[model samples]
Target chain A: MNKFKTTESFENHISKEKRSAKAKAFFINFLLSFYLFFSLFFSSSYLIYEKNILPSFFYFILLAFSFIFSLLWTSKNSSLGSMAIYKTNKFLKNRKELQSEFNLFSFSGIFISLVLILTILLGSILVDINLYLLFSSQGLSGAKRIFSALFQPNWNIISQVLSSMVDTIFIAFLATFIAIPIAFFFSFFAARNLMKNSLLGNSVYTVIRFISNFTRSVEPLVWAVIFSVWVGVGPFAGMLALAIHSVSSLIKLYSEQIESVGQGPLEAIESTGAHPVLVVWYAVVPQIILPYLSFTIYRWDINIRMATVIGLVGGGGIGTLLVQYQGLAQWNEVGTIVIVIASVVWLMDYLSAKLREAIY
Target chain B: MSKTILEIKNLEKFYENGVHALKSVSFDVKQGEFLAVIGLSGSGKSTMLRCINGLVPSSSGEINFQGQDIISLKSKELRLARKSIGMIFQHFNLISRKSVLVNVLSGSLAKVSLFNGIFAKFSKKETDKAMSNLELVGLKDKAYIRADELSGGQQQRVAIARALMQDPEILLADEPVASLDPATSHSVMDHLAYINKELNKTVVCNLHFLSLVRKYATRVIALKDGKLVFEGSPLDIDEAWFKRIYGEQAREVGIE
Candidate 1:
């Protein structure tokens, strides 16, 4: 109710303080933009970590170019420059060099200069990154040889490769199918918006959330290795591993969708005297069904790629065949397997994308 | 005999944030009367209606509806009581992805068995009822169309049909025509008036526009700062009473 109150005294007081405030805001904007430019130059020049004069000079030149570009951007009408100027002119009228304006500039300068020093000191500790390993001549040649082989993808191993690729697809399908329903069930228990009303409900949400997060944190390959050790090597172990991981991952996605389900429909349905379960069925289900389908198809796409990695860990599929051939110096066979897996993955990606677009 | 269908005694709602949205509010809706609740925004008109429907649990009060104290009822009992009281929102909160027919059919959820509901197996009788309700709102032809594909006014009409499927004896409309244009507001208001007159269902509606209250309401009540400030016929709210209900500086804003 106080928000509706407007008095003459309040307007007078605001006008009195307005000039100093606008000038301070203008000074802060100017100092901050300058600090941003200087920091950009310092960081880029410092990254080379070199003693050579010429390269260091070139790096500085690149940094200077970036600084000029940033200044130009910040001066655009859509940017903060025009806003500061407009406010200062509106409030200050004919005044200049106010005490508050000077204080704002000094305060902003000290803060940003401290940040620059800390960034340099911290970045010096963030090394161990080797540019030579990635950008060297030998590294370039190695990548070229591998990519060149993809063009001549040997058709000789088409039979072995095709069957292996089929196994990979089957593994993904079985895993996603088994996981989607389980994930759907868990999502209701895990949604904070649905379950935060009671102690029992809150605890159930927390426990489900914790379990899914813990499961998802461990990579699928690690799960496959453990599963294969427990239930010998084959697609069965791979399927189990993929299903377990997909459940946790999909549960996280599904619960978020459940949480974001519109509250308005829920309220309207609840007014009809529907039970909580029926409320979810009628109101919540309709809103999330399309998103759930899209997420499941996306999960399947992810799982197909994961199946290849899981197979390399001895949970059987195309990836197992891939490692076996690669180990025997059979580059030609490895090339064919890689080509087939890539094609299947591309086809799955395309179909899922189209379906998702249509559904949404 | 015009007996009371619903009665409230000293209703108060202090939300979790300590905002006293409603103070001690008390009123009664006589059977078959179209009572319009008139109030400024934040004057507890909505909270009063919501409390009667049991949409939000009241902090303290007795809401006697259909001879039972609604505020004290537990989960299943409350749901059973609610089945006979349908509500419509200003935004017409229909499930956008669902078809108009399915949205109406969903109103019968509380009365259906758990198995049938889970499988979404509506009986032929229920389907027929749903279709008839759609016909009531003049959206029978659009029953198969998605709720979102319809215009705002059409969606609210669909919501009316959905609420009607509950076979409710009383209806609560929370700013039912607030989001609509002036012409459409009259059209939607006319439907509520029709339902009240022809179907003989008791209605408790919250309205911002005073012109609407004068047109459709048989009795009027006004809330100011969560307290009942005025109650009488719509015509009885004279210039002095309107100033007392709204405010001294407030000008009456009206739709066609």
Candidate 2:
């Protein structure tokens, strides 16, 4: 009886250690979540206040959901005899097929709860502050306001949208076009298999990599702002910003693609007494052409969306028109513009996918 | 006086990884002699051939081609010299996306100016010469087809055609039929032999198959671990000779 009791105590100690390890993991995850939440809260504080939003209800909902999730997760390995633990064990035993369904149900439940809580908080705050009076005086409330202010049957909004769209397309096109030639030179230096001198090759690679990183680190909107100060507003500033971003992204993609090309062709070219440039042209470029095209098209699609957003800060695109509509409190016009932009993006995505498939 | 078309004197190559790939290797080829370099893999056979064409720069050596010391030539002169020495690879490295015609045309780039080469502005005579070379390899009909579309044997033939378009004085074939089936290998070997004999071009080929070396080469040079093990006519080499060169490893692998 004494030996049996000793064994039982040892088993209890092992279980306690396992529980503590799991708790440590959970604490680390909770700390990460808290950091992310606070960062978002601080960054968007001005927007929240201007919109007459209170985040207290959101906090409550987050806390409740987190508590429930932690309970569910911990209960799976719980030593305590509870119905929840039994159910969790059974669910885990059949995990593969049931996992997606469980995750979908839980995620949607949390999301809906958060949205409801935030809406309720914002509604209460707006009511307390009498915000409806401000909207009424500005002709921003009710059905007639949006259409009257937006449509006014004026060509200004239409012309602005058209010009902005052109500028965005041109920015994407010119940047990609210019970047290809520059990347072509740097990719050879970057590829390890091609160059004989490791020191020289690595130095060239490092320098080019530094330039690419510096270009991509700054957002296009920030680039646009700097360029606007230097060269004045309109499409040229947007073009310059997009071009710099493209050089960095294109160099990285092109170098990686060049590096991965099969060594067989390269060796063959080398053995034939061909020059390095010839080897690259005949061997490397042929293999990477399809992938390069696919990447360029994808970048162009991303640039189109970014171009619109950058225009809000005078980068010159559809974003300019959207901002103007917002200033005039024309929500219906904003909705129409949003739909048009979405359709354009969707069309480009479909076309790009088809083209990529055809090439491959 | 008989001209020494190619000569290597005390050629040495030490890889950056500190491997002595070739140690004081030396050999010579007359204007029209077919030489077979027989060696196992990693036995300095490839490094020896690449050094002849100046493809891999020798650490300390003198490669005299026709009379000039090619080892000391700078980039422009080296490129010009390379145009005269044609090479073929084991895997037939034709650009898969390019047609056979364009692949053959690529060989002529060293002879043409960089601007014209980039723009692909070869004269009509150059095109005709390329076509004739393709005809010599019996791949004239497939000249317009993308190289990837061809069979292994056919692609090797296309590579041969490309090399022939260079109008080279020396031809170096690095295991040209290693990737092909036995039947295809025989045909490719026949084509290389025909090019050597009919065109009177000096041929130096690296080969593993002894039967092929016996059938094609006038003289066979064997290497064992970056050292010259055998240098004699094909008739002089027997199973015992191969055994001596490859050692007990040959017996284990059952190459005899």
Candidate 3:
């Protein structure tokens, strides 16, 4: 009788533990769903629909509904509360393990959908987004005038724009060229694998990493403004700005490539009794050369695009000419500059891709 | 009678992550003998080989190579000492993108001046020697091909050729045939045997298979849990000794 009673109690104990677990889940989910929908509904009604206080009658109904929904959501002790209901189709059911945690379609899904829809409504009101504006008479007329003028670019200003475009390309080229060697030199010191051997190496690694991250976080246009103020505004200022930013960006790319190189070849070369410098040249260089070249070309592509933006901040290039015509409302002249920039960028993209492919 | 070329005493390696990889390991390697070291994975076979060459620094021990204590040597002295010790790995460790000739020539990097090494300007003598090593490994025709284009067995042969560029007195092979098929394993083993006999270079090899050890090794040593458990001829390892080393539940698996 005692043995039979023990078995009965063990089964009861398991079910009891399962019930408490389900109840805990239900309570937590009830709080979360209530808070999410409440805030979403309250904010939309108050801000978008211009209601001062939350609608008490509607809120009470929602609270009662959410309580019942959460209870059903946590039934069977499953997770995610029907969040992945759409994934329960025949194709997905065939791959049962790929299905998400929530398996059943329940009332909780309705609450979540309501929260998502109301959140979008609140977001649109906050941003003042009105799709009707696009078709409004005022907006349509302005867009038509600008787009029509843009289609018929001023051919007379083509020569002037071409000179500025050359300046823009030169600025990008010089910036990328100047940054290459500097970034290359710094990359060895920046690599964690190479610099992790000694305390001094680790310190150098940290400092170099910190400096590069700090520089890269600031945009090139901001640097262009700072350089323009420092150097009295020219393509030289733009080149310097791009060069500085490129050095930091390229160092990060190069060092990451260096870090990912296989350690087996390194140990093999070291076993040959080579000097550390020779070891790097033989083992590390061969591994990283192709990736390094690929990354540098990628950087150059970015620098060319950035050079145009920098020019708008009084760092001399085609963007300077673009802003000048734009300020004067000469949309046709602006259109010509934009076409030249677009064609050059497209050409650069094609050339770089071909070069990378050839090297690979 | 052969003389002792290398002697290791009380070798211990404690990695920073607190893995006591090797514990008081000691052994001797005789001149011109094909010595095989066998163990399960993580049993310190690789670590013991690396310690002999000072590739992985030992926590405490004496590694007496020739007459010198290798553990006591400074960095520059160690590099100089490493020239006399050539090492190969299971993966072949060749620079995959480089030509086979360049990969072999790189084995002589220790002898080349930095400026020449930087420009990849190998001396004619070095190039000829590299070619001869390639010829020795029977890959002379494939010298211009990229290292990755070759098959696994061929890549290992190239690695052997690269190691030969050092012309060292001793060759340490860490699981040389671990990554190879049975047919390829024997071929690579045959080359190693030839090198041991013709070149008269002392070889210390780590092996996973007892059959290969029995076939190629003059003597065999076994490590269990980072300690030397058995040291004798391959014929001496009976079934009882195998169970003692590999555990009672183990069954001997043969490659051939």
Candidate 4:
């Protein structure tokens, strides 16, 4: 009689608990959405429509609870709610001891996210931008026509495309090849560890760093345009631009690598009473050689990408051919050019990756 | 008894943060003596050795060597002085990527010209000497092998041979065997001993183990908190002196 009574009561209790959970889930979701819609409505309508502040003012208490117990009553009874409470208690316990505690305060994060949303809304109005136009009707047929033409790939111009692509690769290789030596030269003077002990060395380091940073800040395509104007539209201009830009980037990497070398070898070399040049020769160069080679190959890889873009600004590569086709509205020819550039870029990437593997 | 090759008088080193790493210490090293400096870690033995080569500058002191003051020497003079005094390190400090022969050849940096060294156009004579130096360390067979591939003891021996490339008047070993096993330590110490005994090079080494000090050191000195506390024959260091040198809580560790 006692067992029958307990089983019957347990089944009744289980159903009651589940019923309350279902009801609570629905009610909480409804309350959360209603409270949330007011802020969302205000933020979204800044430029599109003016909002009525009446709802936010009328449900002020509801808004307060929505923000305050945001993670509490909205979550499951024993899961997220209990976990958050447990973490908050743990943080408080650890705070008294002045030990490392988990970062739990979340008001700033929510505020930042809200501010970003508002900025985007206000910025769209100020800039007269419409991201919705990205899905416009006019460019749809153009994209479809280009893609369909990609399958045919103008076989007659294959040789021309191949030659231009090779020129592009050559421009990349030659530029990186040229830049690496210049960068390597500057790296030693630019390195902090090398220059830390002397006033003259410190000045040279700062100047080299500034030059590298300044040159790197200018985009490669812009450099290409400047060089094109200087050299009169040729592969030479492309190569020169890539070389200058790469030198700046490579200098920073190589110098940092030079600084990271082991101090033990440095001390040992210094104690040998070797000259300053000899110290760099024996101690610095050997340690940095592998990493230098690695960085140069990587820069070459990056320059291949630069080669394609520079040609668009009259720096003479596959991109010159690409722009020519596009100007004539020869979508089919442009498709072939795109296919050729992509495959070559992919090939160059593969080759460099293989080379890097062999080096390591 | 040999003549004194190096002399120190009233040495003082005050670091930037006001830590006195070496107090007003004084000592003289004879030409062919094997002197071991025993002390706790950070007790300024390394600093003292570095001061001898002008690797670390003394704030106030006389580091008189071969009738010349090392402390106040100019850059070129310092480099020239360093050429004759070869130093080996605890970590071996070999360029791990280079071959053993190249590393040994690097020791000839002091003697080579700036242009020749940068291009690594080592002369035939330099090459022969590097090979001979390798042979001395029994690393002749491993000449073309990468330095990091060698065992710790072997690397330290290579370091010893590299130092010999200077044809040094004085060899400084700063905790040379501190990273080696007991057997490896003895082997390394034996080479140092051979260099000291057969080649007749004066050796000043910093050691942690008392047993190694007793076995190898012809004369011993102990420093406590940067102050030189004991200096005499190794046999004279009794229990009371040991206690005072290392501190009251210190227990002696022995490596057979």
Candidate 5:
């Protein structure tokens, strides 16, 4: 009796497995067909809209063809979870034999490749790309003139470029220095884990998070424009702009570090009856100090790159000199400023990377 | 007869996710007894230990410790109350990057002013006491090393030393040996046993193995599905009671 029961249960298990496999195959096929139809229809419609030469009837016909092709292919092929399709009733008796029916190149693979090529073609049309025009006489001459002038940089402006480069670097330095303490103060309030206890704490968390997010959404260029109007066009304006953005960015980095701190040490310190400040000092500080230093060094690197650009908006630095020389069409002077900025940015990036490596 | 130092009445804890971690449970702890709370995982053992120290506030209960209800205490009062109750975790929750000596000295932050605590300026007396506690845990030589550099057993021993620096009246240990190997578990347990017997501090510990309870605990309490199932001497939990507490399919597994 036990042997008979075991045989029956084994049959039941196999039947259940077969049913689940069938359902899974159907779901996968349905999703693939739906995706194929959408991609084909959308790409064709986008092409017709952007090019605007094809008629409305042409789009409708393409859409209908995609829909009908996906439907008919899905119904006829009925993919069997792998590359094989369900074609005959004979293979239904043994699922294991279905593996031998695998195809090296399937219709779905061909259809997907066709759709990808169509997408690339549509992207070229959308961008209004004309590769032939780029290598035309007019384009080559424009490029040649800039290249010849750039190769002959004006050495007379080397002293001016060096001094303005120092100003740009100092703006980044002072901005980061000012932002460090402010971001450190706001980060504790912004961390959800730290301020989740009371209604007042939750409100402070929301307010700090909202203000940082709001300020961060405004790009440094826009902020530099605003600060130039307020503080008058100088390195101070650039410094203020970078400082504001850095505080928000650093708050986000610092608070996320605080949230991921191991709760074990925090609980241990709390259990010691330490004051709340001391709990944060002892537990949270040790875990976050290295990460915070790493993030600050990273932020300083970004600020240096931004300061060079912020000077373009009348905030005084090497960027102001480059823009001035460009406006006058003195490409040689512009080339000198460009080289100074590039070399400085590269050195800053390398130093920050090394500093971050040392910290970790 | 020993005096009851801690009294818990109808202790109920409902977590924010609507998990009823602890049902209406009540128990008493004597002044100097080593009480072992045993249960399966998620049976409210950790939650109960946390609630007693006001770490995880009880949903509704009265935990009377030294003439004060721990659940009703304000933040300042809670900090003051927590000073007398030293707790250690299974993970040995030391500030991993800090020196072992600094980790121990952090336990005295409750009594120091906020200004002094901020600068981590402990007095010579406190430093000496921290050293003595490290010596008690047989880790005086390891004091200058980083807390994370130690082995698991050594880290746990340092955690015990840090807890001892508080000079607490009651020590709550949450599954102190659950993360340790059997041999290391015995060594840590021996230190706890020494604290309970020689120093005469009341020790309330959460444990998993019945054999360890039989060896170390003066009294045992068993919890099942958030309800107290048994409260008696450890030796009284024989085969029948064990089967009932741990479920019928369960069999005792010994570490040694």
Candidate 6:
């Protein structure tokens, strides 16, 4: 009788634990539903006020239906409730899985936030003056006008596009070429394992990082305009601007690549009585070189496109031609220039992909 | 008896995060002697080996190698000191992208100048020497192959060859076969033993398995919680001694 009672009580205890878990899950989900409803209400109100646009009452109706649907779903599917709780409870049960999930979530969140911020900033600027206003001020209108002007094959338009493209390409190339050596020095200081003294290493890294941020923050177009006033219009001004930006970007990428290298090879090199610089050259550089090359090529391709845009401000290359075409109301020519630029960018993309495959 | 080639006097290291990695450890290694350090994780065995090569700077201690205090040596002097001591890691850390030949040649970086090193302007003699080292590790055929192309055992052989290229007087191996299979572990240990016997190089190795240490180590040192608890011959280390060194708690945890 005593043994039977013990068995029965053990079974009862397990069932009680299960019941409490279910209850906890249900309560948590109920809170989530309430929070969502509140958030929906406030978001809808804010959207209406900000945009001066009312979403149809149907959206509110849909929200109410969804909430009701979720409640019913949770009641029937305790398994689903368990899964939802599992996300939060995961760290206690399986640490590796939790860490990986957290990493992915945070990385994606940061990336999405950056994209949203950039889009909003750019949209606000573009919406005010508008691309149409800038184009219409020169008296070019309709797709027909653009087509005719392009079909007529004006040499002036062709020349302007060619120059801008050349200027852009040259700027990217020159900037990258000049920045590579400098970035190498900065990356050495940035690498955690390379430097023994953390304070000195961190200070060096911070200073270089600050310099890079400052350089990259000032857009190439702005830099070109500033340089144009200082050195007058040409490819030289554009090159300087791109070079400054390249230094900052390359340093960041290179340093990160350096940091990610397996410490094993470095430890091996250090053990062999190799100097710090030698260790870096052997262990660190070998690991990072392929990735660095790929990043550089990609950056160069981007700079070429930017160089063309910056040329409108007289920094030199195809942008100068683009500006001239717009001033002359030659929209068709502008379209042709855009096509050529797109083709070049596409070519770079294909080549870089192939090269990365070969190296990697 | 051979002269004492290396001496450690009250060597201590405390990490910036306040982990007492090594606590006032002292030992001497004679020329051409084979010493195996046996310990579980966080035992300060690896830390002690790193201090000899000046890889991990000692917080308060003196490492005297060839009658010179290695701890006080700065930049170039440190590099010069490092050249005489070669190290092998458990993971066989080779530059995966580079060919085996280039990996081996990396060991000679200390002797070569910065300009030659960067551009890989290694002399024909240096190249031949690297090839010979590869031959010693029996990977001469895999010279042109990338380091990643080889198996774990093969990669370890390549690493050994890379260290040999340094023509080091002392070889420090930190759990060099921890990543390999049992059969491969024996082979790698055999190679290390052969190197010690043939080249008359002083070898201090950190080992996980006691069997391997018994087979190779002339002198065994055991560490527990950053403290050296046992320093004696292999024959002297019986099961009871091991129990004392590891403790009943560690035995229950299955540390062996």
Recovered fraction of real interface contacts per model = 0.56, 0.32, 0.62, 0.55, 0.71, 0.58
Model 2 Cα lDDT, one tens digit per residue, B10-116? 77776533356776778778788889998889999988888777767777778999678887887667767877888998888888998999888887766666567
Candidate 4 residue lDDT tens string, A244-286: 9999999999999989998888888888889988888788888
Look at candidate 3 and give me any clashing residue pairs: none
Candidate 6: tens digits of C-alpha lDDT, residues B78-178 = 88888888889889999888999999998888888788988988999889999988888888999999999999998998898889888888999989999
Task: Give per-residue lDDT, candidate 2, residue A70.
Answer: 50
Per-residue alpha-carbon lDDT of candidate 4 for residues B38-70, written as tens digits (9 for 90 to 100): 889989999999889987777777999877899
Error of 5 at A296 (Å): 1.2
Worst 10 residues of 4 chain B by lDDT: B12-21
lDDT of model 5 at position A189 = 93
Worst 10 contiguous positions by lDDT, candidate 2 chain B:
B247-256
What residue runs in model 4 are displaced by over 4 Å at the alpha carbon?
A: A1-131, A134-153, B1-3, B9-20, B23-25, B119-132, B140-146, B236-249
Query: Model 1, B127-221: lDDT tens per residue?
Result: 99999888888889999999999988898889898889898989999999999999888878988999999999999999999999999999999
Query: Model 1, which residues run further than 4 Å from truth?
Result: A1-127, A133-155, A325-333, B97-99, B119-150, B240-249
Q: How close is every model to the real structure, measured as TM-score?
A: 0.76, 0.68, 0.78, 0.76, 0.80, 0.71
Give me the candidate number with maximum TM-score: 5
Model 1 lDDT per residue over A1-360, tens place: 121112343344345555455444445455555556555555554556542233456555655664565456444333343345534543333233322232324543455566667566446645546778889999999888877775677897899888888898999999999999899999999898899866789999999999999999999999999999999999999999999999999999999999998889999999999888989888898889989999999999999999999999887889999999878856767888888888888999999899889989
Model 5 alpha-carbon drift over 4 Å, by segment: A1-46, A49-137
Query: DockQ numbers for every candidate?
Result: 0.31, 0.13, 0.28, 0.22, 0.31, 0.26
**Which ranges of candidate 6 are over 4 A from the true structure?**
A1-160, A182-186, A189-192, A196-206, A327-333, B1-3, B119-132, B244-256
What tens-digit string does per-residue lDDT give for candidate 2 at A132-195? 6757855554556656543443443556666667767787678768777776677667665665
CAPRI-wise, candidate 2 is incorrect
Per-residue error for A343 in candidate 6, Å, reads 3.8
- Docking level for model 1: acceptable
Among all windows of 10 consecutive residues in model 6 chain B, the one with the lowest summed lDDT is: B247-256
For candidate 6, the per-residue lDDT at B80 reads 84
Tens digits of per-residue lDDT, candidate 5, B1-256, equal 3999899998887654335678888999999999999989999999999999999888776999989999889889999999999999999999999999999999899979999999889999999999999999999999999999999999999899889888889999999999999999999999999999999999999999988999999999999988999999999999999998889999999987
